[model samples]
Target: MSNTEIEDRQFITIAIKNGLVSKEKVDRAYILQRRIYTQAKVHKPICDILIQMGIITEAQKAQLNAARNVLMGKREEPADEVADDALPDINTARELELTISKDGLQAFIHPEHHQVQDVRIEDLRLFLNRRRIKFGVVDDGQIKSYLSQSPLPEKSFLIAVGQEPESPTPPELKFYFDTNPLRIGRVNEDGSIDWKDRGKLPQVNAGDLIAEIIPGNPGKPGKNVTGKTIVPPKLPKIRLKRGKGVDRSEDGHRFVARTGGMPQLIRKNRVQILSTLNIDGDIGLETGHVEFDGHIEVNGIVQAGYRVKGASIRAKELYNAEFEISGDIISLGGIYRAKIQSNGNLRASHIHTSDLTIFGDVVVEKEIFESTIETNGQLVIDNGTIISSKISAKKGIYANDIGTEASKKCDLDVGIDHRLEREVNLLKADIEKNGKLVQLRKADIEKARQRSDYLNTQLGEIAQEQDGYMVKQRDMDAKLSEAEADKDELQIAFYQKTIRELGEKRNEIDAIVEKYLEEDEGILANIPVYERDVAETEGHIEAAEQKIKALEIESEADPGHPEIKISGTIFNGTCVTSPKATLTTREDYTHTSMRETDVEDGVTTKKFRIKTTSL
Candidate 1:
């Protein structure tokens, strides 16, 4: 073969190896060229044939030709020179068009054709001058560059832009305390809901700065492209008015609390502070829902379906009501079917069918029946009996009697902080969920592997079929060439038809092979992704387990040695659990005390055990 023929073959080889074109498409183009030559007695180049078939673009052909020339020790022409030679002659008759936005904020310049002559920087400047664009004009250097470009940009060029006027700042009132009251329960960090944690009221001390007036300024005006001044909107005026329990500073710009109480906004411009809220009668429809930032005192019972919140509370009785107090609570009468949460100590007469979460100590004068109480401090019931109650206390329990013979079982858990125990339970649940997610990810990976294997088998079968078709097509091509040389028209037609049929069959096999290969690749790719997800989920589970272990260690280090002490008869079915041990009474014990003690079971190791003794 000649050097030119070798170069052409090298170009085709390079294009195929670089993934610029497929080998199958190149082969088809060659067949088309051969057919044309056989019928018209005219030969066409492979590159030209490929381009005519829309398989390769002109730029792609140029790139391949350049590479082939470099490899064959021929000098390659510059890319810009080649591009210039390929471009058509410039259109000198077309004029430049200018467009401005109706708002006079933007201006753009357009050319009639891609290759236009006589486009100057002065022409663009004149267009802007005619449009009276006076502000935010684009740099002149950019306009010159746009005019010098070989092929003008298809989109319009931004020549000028205008500035917009700024809006004025309105006067605002800034309060030091919380203005929006929290009326609902709060959700804890561990996704647990605390129904009694209604938002705290805004409180202030005597002489504390409560509010201030912030003055606003008038914004500056702006000039547009047409030299028109744009004025800003007017600022609203605000005045501060002092109400009861509020004092103004000497400058009259700051407001301070005169007394220690809750600061409240009385109308839109008034500030008032309430020191205490007093209810002379029952808190029902007459009092509505009572919420205050200061102390609250109720003379009668809090009726059902009502909620009360205060920093500290004192009530005569609570009946099916809810109370959220940040400080201490004192109830003189019995609490029935009520829910109370207090951050400080609680002293009540009797608690029945109630749910209480107290952060401080609890003292009851009467009996506590069918109740759930969780306290971080000690529970004292010197003269009361606790019946069928579930109590969890971090400190200890001191009661007269627990669990009557006819009453339901009473469960008591002490020593460990209830908050830590709750967190551990939540972590355990998270670990379980993460474990299930890991299993699901593993299952998905297994399914993907199975699919990949099936697709591989299918692709292998398609490869064999494609090979068979190629062999038959080659044989038919040889027969067709022989008949053409012998001038046998009938034999030529038959062999040509046979070759085309074989080529069509090969194409069908190739399509099937491609589809199978794509499916196999997709499955293989996702297997690693699923594996990564499983690994991440497993990591999360491990972290949660480690956290639980740390929390357990902390819980086990209780220094209080909390226990249940009963001074009167303790009947059967009364169970008490400490951090280290648990004790359940099987028979009645009179005047007994229960505590945790370390005991040895015939070995060197010692474990905690609950011991009972008669008082």
Candidate 2:
């Protein structure tokens, strides 16, 4: 017997192996089939009897038929012929391929054939049975109709469905300011410091929770088409890289600030804490010397002879004290007679000291009187006056008015380069020299032409005189011959003397004409050389002028417009200096921006005009 026939002998065993029917159910169906034959005296297939007795559903029947067809290697009949469902005696089922969605919520089946034939319910059941897919909301008719369209055999149809996995959410970070170690400092709209909430020093106590880290959840597992489990992707751990004065929790999730001072989160991870040493009163013998790495805030005046150093130093009033800060220096009341140096911005109410040097910008609310101030950045006096002070800014200076008529010696300095202006002036001088040389060469050419013309005229006069002398000598010779022939001795002697004298005059005229001709020829020959010289000089002059024009354009293009604006009156004696120029006020100027205009000096370039204008 063929292998198909041999496998078909145990239909119940095949159904059980395909997971469509259990062994116990097959045993019960066999007993019922034997009782039907013995009591009703009628023989019938056990599978048909199991279906009629409601022991097996239509799906199980289809599974048995599909299993038998797979064993016999039978394929579905053509759609134009008899239907597979009508051929109950013969197995008209085909093998099918199964596919599952990514989520495993849907299962699809397709016939394993080049051209799809009509699909029966049995084919779908057998495909699902082999994969051990047990639970799904199956629609057999929809699957059958989908396969009837003669779709490409490799195309999958929705045959079974399953559940999907629920993924987990990641953790997030939360910051706490008031309750935590870091104190929040508020800034007003006018850029004034607010000390209402902040204490003497912004600090965080040790073991204080600075941030909260929420926990993440793991997702539930799902089932795939082959009854296999599907797992969700793993999530990354959430934690900040701790810096000084901060430490991570034991769970490697939460963060704690260990030190006290100003807390700053840098680079999205590191937490830096700076300590603060506050001074409630003035700087004296009681307070002693003060030096800190973080910040210093003095409530009262800073006495003289005290040297203070910190990152940032804030004083209510400073008088004759020396301060060195790497950061900012802010004086709320004023700075009077104090010598201060800072790396960052410096702000004061009124600066009347003679010694203040800052690396950053300096902003004063009131007048800066007789103060020797120097900063690498700008100097800004907001609606304030500047009196007889020597102020220098590497960038520029801006104030209401520099000095009054009484304090006319106030000096203000800005940043310009004098080298560029000097170079431009030198180019202009060279261009002028080249132009003059070109004109001189042209004049030389014209003078050569005039000299040539005069020589030609002299040569013509000499030629005319020589022709007259030759004719006179010839007439004298001819007359002497005639006299000798007539036997006149006295006439012959007179003619001979006249002819000799004419010959000498003609020789002198010929010598003069020859000298004039040589001079005229020389002038004519040198005219072309002189003309070439003039053309070359003209070209050199044009090139030099073009370079000079380019230099002028570069001088105009220089972007050095630094002005000191004053809303009030600027006194005489106030001197403002830029990189390339300096300006001293001659008269009292009112409500004007005192600026310097770039003026190229021939010998020494004056960069600033020291001019003022209302606009």
Candidate 3:
């Protein structure tokens, strides 16, 4: 038999033998209790079952308890009483000898002075204070655990540790560079400073973030053994100092260049931006290599084997100097045996360079011989000879004569429309790419929004279902309370079963509500990310569209026209080029004009003839 069944049988036999209760009443109560336990898994005591079923009374249970106590030979518990006149005191149960290190960074104690049980936490604190070792504190539990170890402090054990003060961080300067400084001079492979460009000029653009003054960090205060605060020495002040052509930030943290110029750190303190570095004489050992931020003016020739860079240059003469220029160049004398690159227009009396690349228009006054020239704008040569040179221009090429009488070949390429065309095509391609991306981003945002709406609907439905379950549970509780107050056994049992069923329904609703809320939170979080993606994609699409429109306008404005007018005689063996065709001179002609014209065959043809009127 089960333990519960044996206990029930023993209790029934005892009650029947003592004549305290009848077998029929006990059996009825036991059957009811078993049915309740089997249905709901609620195990009620036998006395409570009997009382609920009106088969036993409280007075009878009390008499039975007295009899049971006598049979078991047990005594009852006694009542309590109060005491007066209690005194409070600190713990002084044990003695400990504490010692601090010379630097006040460490504190140790000897645990052999007392037994582990006799050690007191308050007495240890008092001893530490009296010895003026007040920086670090060891807890009571840690001390007790340490003392419990078999190894006593024959070697003193470290308990408390003090903190050290942090040193000050000095201020420094940070540079914002646009060009690689290492490329200016000879650079080493290993990661060490190259002093070749130590005094080299540093360049900056207008409104450029030149340098930032990193503020110094103050020292942190520390505590000594006696809890005395140790203050650190003050650090030197560093400022964001500026000179002419330089500006400082409002917060005094950054130094910015107000004008486009070369930066110079003078007197180890202030920064100044020199807009133009003037060289009165030739660019040689006297002027060093030029690397200025703004315009450069060389009154004399730039010698061979040197590099000169500037925003714009007005050199009287240039010879074999490597030049990287950003603005227009005006060379009054000539250029010979040099390599030059100009970001803006170029004007030179004569160019005999091996390589010349100009982004803007090119104007050569005299002869351009044995050179390769590439220009994005118009190529104009005034009464000059282009001998044995390759010249290409985006707009048109104009020269008085192309080749010499010695049959020196000169290649000329004009009517070049690819510059603006390429830009327009690239912009169109970017627009299409960004458009597709925007569509994809829009779709993603819509999908997320739809999912969010669905989740919100589910959340609302769950909330409604939960509200109904709550109402039913509350009603069941009220009915159970009413039944218990009336002392009606049948009503109480019926209401208890109803309440249990309502509780199970409420639990199901709670699980559903929790699931809906969690899914809703995830959807809400993803909504912002999708929204941001959509916005960024749209912005890219708009920017690409604007660029395409601007390039289209520029391409429309580019008209390819080639024109060459000679004031003097054009010799034989000279080659001339037009937008449509090339003409080779067979004989000398005076006041010659070379141009393109539409022929009757509907193809544009080149015409070279002696001019009667001014073009």
Using TM-score, give the best candidate's number: 1
lDDT of candidate 3 over 271-387, digit per residue (tens): 767677678989998877889876686778899888988776777788887989865566766889889887667767788855887767777777899998877777767457787
lDDT of 1 by residue, 1-615 (tens): 856457558868866644456978988887997899899987677788888999777866776676566655786742543442221111111255657788766777777766664576654554455346567787888877877876677789887777777878876689998643332234468633354554566788999999998877778787666667777777766667887789998877799999888776532356777677888989999989999876687888899999989766777888898999876677767889999998766767789999999866777767999999998777878667999999988888888888888999999987768877688889989999999999999989988888888888888877887788888888888888899999999999999888888888878878888888888888888888999999899999999999998667645543454677787877887888987888888898888878777754544447787878787
Candidate 2, 6-46: lDDT as tens digits: 54355666655545567677777778867987999776776
Candidate that would win on lDDT: 1
lDDT of 2: 0.67
Worst lDDT window (10 residues) for model 1? Answer: 85-94
Q: Which is the winner by TM-score between candidate 1 and candidate 3?
A: 1
Which residue runs does candidate 3 get wrong by more than 4 Å? 1-276, 281-293, 300-309, 316-326, 332-343, 349-360, 365-372, 382-390, 400-411, 417-419, 422-426, 471-560, 563-615
All candidates: CA RMSD in angstroms?
Answer: 26.3, 32.5, 34.6
Candidate 3 — which pairs collide?
A: none
Question: What TM-score does prediction 1 earn?
Answer: 0.47
State in Å the error of residue 336, model 3: 6.9
Candidate 1 vs 2: which has more TM-score: 1
